[model samples]
Target: MSAERVHRTTHDVTVAAPAGVVYGLISDAVQWPLYFPPNVHVEQLEFDGERERLRMWATANGEVKSWTSRRVLDAVARRVEFRQELPARPVRSMGGTWIVEPLGADRCKLTLLHDFTVDGDDPGAVAWVERATDTNSTAELANIKALAERWANLDELVLTFEDSVRVNGPAELVYDFLHRVADWPELVPHVSRLDVVEEEPGVQVMSMDTLTADGSSHTTESVRVCFPDAGRIVYKQTATPLLMSAHTGEWTVEQDETGATVVSRHSVVLREENIERVLGEGATVAAARRYVREALGRNSTATMNLAKSHAENAVTVL
Candidate 1:
């Protein structure tokens, strides 16, 4: 517990979602009430691309109570803290923090600490508020855990299809075509937008917002490069939905004696932040790799097939 003398309460819960996913949902303050109880509402009054000044509304005993708060983010720590400011109704001050830790490859533990002080004018009322907050805090933590776990189960929803065709051109030509990642939208169906932001000497960092098979959109940062000598090009995600950390992997290509290439993407590392959020404690690097493989192997197969088709077709045209 923090050393502050404010009324303090702490609660912990475990969620099944990848830590990155859980952190995203919680950090998106606008989306807080989506999983919490109906009594809560979040409104943003000002945002400076860093922190947000917001207001929360709730119904207590059929009475409408509101408070203004500032939400601060500690990206490296994966914690969110909120401090109260306005509408001081007997509750002079308040604040709480949410913490996430890795449990296993597929599970994460979350802890929430709340510290508050009752107004001197109404100590009894403040005590009552503290009790209610304590109980509700537990319930809210449980609900958030449930929400994250549900998303983690999406590993079951992934479907994969894989096939390859031989391209007659040099592996370099095929690799180069793959290297021009800016052309992905012209080749992939579901990929509707591709924005290349930076193309430096050896690396290309681009913004990718793709629509899922279910028509939902996910935006992230990606980088790519080609190793012609190795007959391979690798693509990796550099950003996530919520956390500032990076998540990425690579693809390798090997040319057969017959001039055809056997290209496959090897799932590399899971994002550390993701590992912390999904598996809070008792999780090791090996365990995270296994979990990521089990959850994302199918997608890797499908991606390989896509690359195979593109390479073969481009070779034929050349």
Candidate 2:
């Protein structure tokens, strides 16, 4: 029998940042959802400082796919190598390396290389895998370059915060309330309209219209992954508000001695160019940060409160 065919591709970018900085950004897979457009979430399953295992979820050609990866990080060499432990469908095997080469004191060359074999070595499967790898690799490289170049201002551009409430009831009810987001339009006051599609179990694609404090409405679309047993739901907003370039969040329910605590966490990247237009003239990044924090916190707090009520009232009624 002939050897199986393997496809190889490489994508590279020049980043106006230190090699160490670029390496740090690529090594920390947990924060990828915040920085990379294609990545939705990453869970670090195992880590031993230099070697790690990760469970990652990402969008490929508009569809969400998940896989487990084993990574080896070499900080001194500014390189990272990864192989998919369980490649998603259409892919038989996938592995890649990231190399960050220092060009100057404050410049680096970032390169991504991928090699993969398709299931059955079918032409259609090979093409699909090629497109996905190309799309995701290009996006990842571009995002790394953009963020690395702006490392100095990352603090001003990225915002993260959380809101929580104590529910005087079972964690299951609270999780149920969060998981059934399709009912948010009637149950949540700020959610004026919502459409949810769940083609795959535990994965949701939602389009929602939310009313602001000023009575205006804005629409957003998101992909959400739910973990019922863990009482956690993580989501990335593919479509964001005027002031945000990217947004990702999580809802978690924790059970304690007294009752359950529900928390909502939000991480947002500001659109600096839209700040003046959205918040009026002379608005600084700080102002935009505060505005976004307040707006998102307010909505999250509302949702948390309602979830608490739903859980508590359900217990009371029963």
Q: RMSD of each candidate?
A: 16.6, 1.3
- Displacement of residue 14 (Cα, Å) in model 2 is 0.7
Q: Show where candidate 1 strays beyond 4 Å.
A: 1-5, 121-123, 152-318
**Local error of candidate 1 at 113, Å?**
1.1
User: How many pairs collide in each candidate, listed in order?
Assistant: 15, 0
lDDT of 2 by residue, 1-318 (tens): 445598999999999999989999999999999889999999999999999999999999889899999999999898999999998998889999999999999998999999999866899988888898889999889888888888999888999999889889999999998999999999999999999999899999999999999999999999999999899999999889889988999999999988999999999999888999999999999999999999999999998888888889888543
Best by lDDT: 2
Clashing pairs in 2: none
Model 1 accuracy (lDDT, Cα): 0.60
TM-score of 1: 0.45
Q: Tell me how far the alpha carbon of residue 268 in candidate 2 is from the true structure, in angstroms, after superposition.
A: 1.2
Q: lDDT by residue for model 1 over 204-262, one digit each (tens)?
A: 66787666545767787655544567765544454554321223344555576666654
The Cα local distance difference test for each model comes to 0.60, 0.92
Displacement of residue 193 (Cα, Å) in model 1 is 48
